[model samples]
Target: MKLKSFLSNLPARVILLIYSVIVLYPLLWTVTTSFKTTNEFYENPWSMPKSFQWTNYINAFKEASIGSYFVNSVLVTLLSMAICMILSFMAAYVISRYDFKAFRWMKKMYLVALFFPVAFKIVPLFQLLGDMHLLDSLFGLVLAYSATTIPFTIFLMAGFLESISKEYEEAAMIDGCSRFGVLFRIIAPMARSGMITVAIFNFMSYWNEYIMALSFITTESKRTLTLGIAYLMEVQRYATDWGALFAGLVIVMIPTLVLYALLQRKITAGINVGGLKG
Candidate 1:
């Protein structure tokens, strides 16, 4: 029995180790390359640098408007996430709790929208934004991001909300709580896990978003990290600065890693709870 149990777990552990190495290797390589000089990197592509060149990171920030890009990305991502959460939560609650005539149709519409690709709407979106005079603005990007994220956020939140017992709301009403009060004080608390799950998903999507940011943000200083990183590749065409490029890649990756480290546990728990209903 003991031997069987050990054998059963061994394969899973080995697979986990292999997957971890596969995911981490590129990140490790990028960080190591960032510390190498350009010549050293070409000569020893796979080896660690003999001397750590911390100046590459400094150069990356000085040469590129990395600081400004970072701030823009953060602001846009946060604003979009906040707006998406509130709008999705309210919409999901209505869809889940109400027995209106169009509730079923509304639910189906949102689900269908979730399957549609953003690329399909690009032309129309661009025209609309142009007409609104929102072209090439961070605020425009934020609005677009929020709109794109809402369908998925509503879908996920609706699933979680549907799983909740309506009795909780009724009980609150008996205690003289207003609908808004019950939602804010009780139902929202119960849906915390789902909210966190949606927030994390939206954050990751917006933070790494490249296509829309590329299309909408024209000014160099207004570009997001992904856009700024692309400029490094363009510069490399003239003379390859692999060290500086890798340094920039590392800088871009740090925020994402830090965010995941901070919120991964909450995200996992939220996913587990949310999946129970779906």
Candidate 2:
């Protein structure tokens, strides 16, 4: 019986193995190619490098000025995420705990907003930012990112908040905790995993976002890592510095991979808890 069961699953396992290779091959190729010299790449694109070219990363940072762009991205993403999380937490707490008509309507509105694409808001956002003198500015970009992401963030947060028992808040209140204190010290900590899950999702979205960055920012100094990579690709088209281009890509991918690897367990637990309770 055991042998028969194993034989039945063999085809499915083989198919999954093939699918994994197909998915991972491009990523593997890009990493290997980043370490290859121009001549080595041209000679045989499929072959690994004889020696790792650390200079490719150096050129990407110094020549392409990816360092500055990286700083700008970090600033923008962190600021936006901070703002989005704080606001989303407060709003979700209210929407989840309060049974008022206005809060219910607001919840529905946010849910409806999630269905609309970001591209739909481009014209109005551009006009609004231009009027506010925020166009081409990093702060403005942060605000735009925050606003666009809030609806979904709130949605996720509300689910987690709903899962949390009101008894915790009530007990804290009995112990002389103010509403804000209960929220910050008790509720926030209790929902820690959910918060991290939402944050990681937002980080990836804010980090890799290109269309909004391209549309809003015109100044080279305010460019994000995504913009820097796009510009690097354009430069590579003429200069053919494929090594540096791939190196830039690797730089952009590192943070996300590291963050995911570290918090993957939290992501699974948070999603499961939120899904089941909410």
Candidate 3:
């Protein structure tokens, strides 16, 4: 029976292995290439570096102005994620806990927003930002990111919130806890996994987002990591600073990698918990 099951699953295991390699190979190549000198890369392209060229990272930071972009990205992503998560949490709490007719359409609206492409709304967003004198500013980009993500963020957290037992809130209220207290002191702890999951996903989205950053930020000083990478690519086309280019790519990828590594278990648990309860 064991042998039969193993044989039946062999093709699936093989396919999964192939897919994993396909996804990981380029990431491995990029990491290897980031540590190689231009001459070494040109000579072999696929071979491992003779020696790790740490200068590639230094040059990427100093010469490519990626350090500034990195800071900008960090600020924008952190602030945007904070705002998105806070608002989404509160909104999701209400939507899930309340049995009101008024709130019924709100979830549907957010679902609609999920499908609504930001591209179609860019013109209005641009005009509104410009009117508010926020165009080409990091704050503007932060606001744009926060507002746009709220709908989906709300949707995601609402699922987890819905999965939570209202008895927790009821008991807290009986113990003299205010509604706000019940939310923060009681419900928030129970929904910790969901919050982490939301934070991780939003962090990745805010970090890697390029199109909105590109559209809103015209000033070189305010550009995010994504813009910095794009600018690095343009410079590399003529300069051929392959080492710096790859280093920039690696730098861009590091945060998301760290975040996922740390919170991957919570992400899985959050989803499973929500799914089972729902």
Candidate 4:
């Protein structure tokens, strides 16, 4: 029986291994390509280079305002992430804990919101930002990102909140803790997985968002990394810097990797932490 089971699993394991290699190969290729000099790239696109052009990173950082664009993305992503997390947490908390009519509507309504395509609202957004003199501004972009993301974030957070036991709330109340204290000290900490997961999703979404950034920002100085990459593409027509372009892409990917690496470990811990009273 054990031999039969191992044989049956072998095919599935082989297929999965093949799939993993397929997915990872392109990423490896991109990293290797980033290090190659232009001449080396042209000479042998696939083979390893004699020496890595570390300066490609410096060039990408300097030439196309990639560093400035990186800074802009950080500013926008942080503000957007903060706004989305705070608003989602509050809305989810109220709807889950309180049994009011309007709060009830929020749960069903946000579900409907997810069904609608984001493009449907872009024109109105463009006009609204323009009217407020916020077009092309980071603050405006942050607001746009936060507003569009809230409904979904709220839904995710509320689902998590709904799963948690209200017995915790009752126990806290018996101990003379106020509603606000119970929420902050107990509920919020227990929902760490939801918060981190939603926050990371929001961060990745806004950080990589190209369309909104392009539609809103025109000035080179104010462009986010997404826009900066597009700008790099346009600039490449006149001057070839494929190495730098690849370097910029690698830079853009680093933050997302770092965030997941740091936060992913906590997602499982968050759920179990609630059970440990001490």
Which candidate's TM-score is highest? 3
Best by lDDT: 2
Pairs in clash, predicted candidate 4: none
Clashes of 1: 0
TM-score (C-alpha, index-matched) for candidate 1? 0.94
List RMSD in Å for every model shown.
1.6, 1.4, 1.3, 3.5
* Stretches of model 2 off by over 4 angstroms after superposition: 275-278
Return the lDDT, model 2, position 75. 98
Candidate 4 per-residue C-alpha lDDT over 1-278 given as tens digits, one digit per residue, 9 for 90 to 100: 99999999999999999999999888888889899888888888898767889999999998767899999999999999888888888888888878999887868898888887867778899999999999989999999999999988887787788878999999999999998898889988888876776777788899889888888888778999998988897887788778998899888988988888888767555434431221
By lDDT, is 2 or 4 better?
2
Q: How would you encode candidate 1's per-residue C-alpha lDDT over 1-278 as one tens digit per residue?
A: 99999899999999999999999999899999999998898797999899999988887888766778889999999999988899989999999899787987888888899887878767777888999999999999999999998988988898888878999999999999998998889889999988887887788899899989888889987899899899878988887667888888998888778878998888888877763353
Worst 10 residues of 3 by lDDT: 269-278
Instruction: Report lDDT (CA) for all predictions.
Output: 0.87, 0.93, 0.91, 0.85
Q: Better model by TM-score, 1 or 3?
A: 3
Model 3 residue pairs with clashes:
none
Q: What is candidate 2's lDDT per residue for 144-257, written digit by digit as tens?
A: 999999999998889999999999999999999999999999999999999999999999999999989999999998999999999998988789788999999999989999
lDDT for model 2, please: 0.93
- Where in model 1 is the C-alpha error above 4 Å? 276-278
Arrange candidates by TM-score, descending: 3, 2, 1, 4
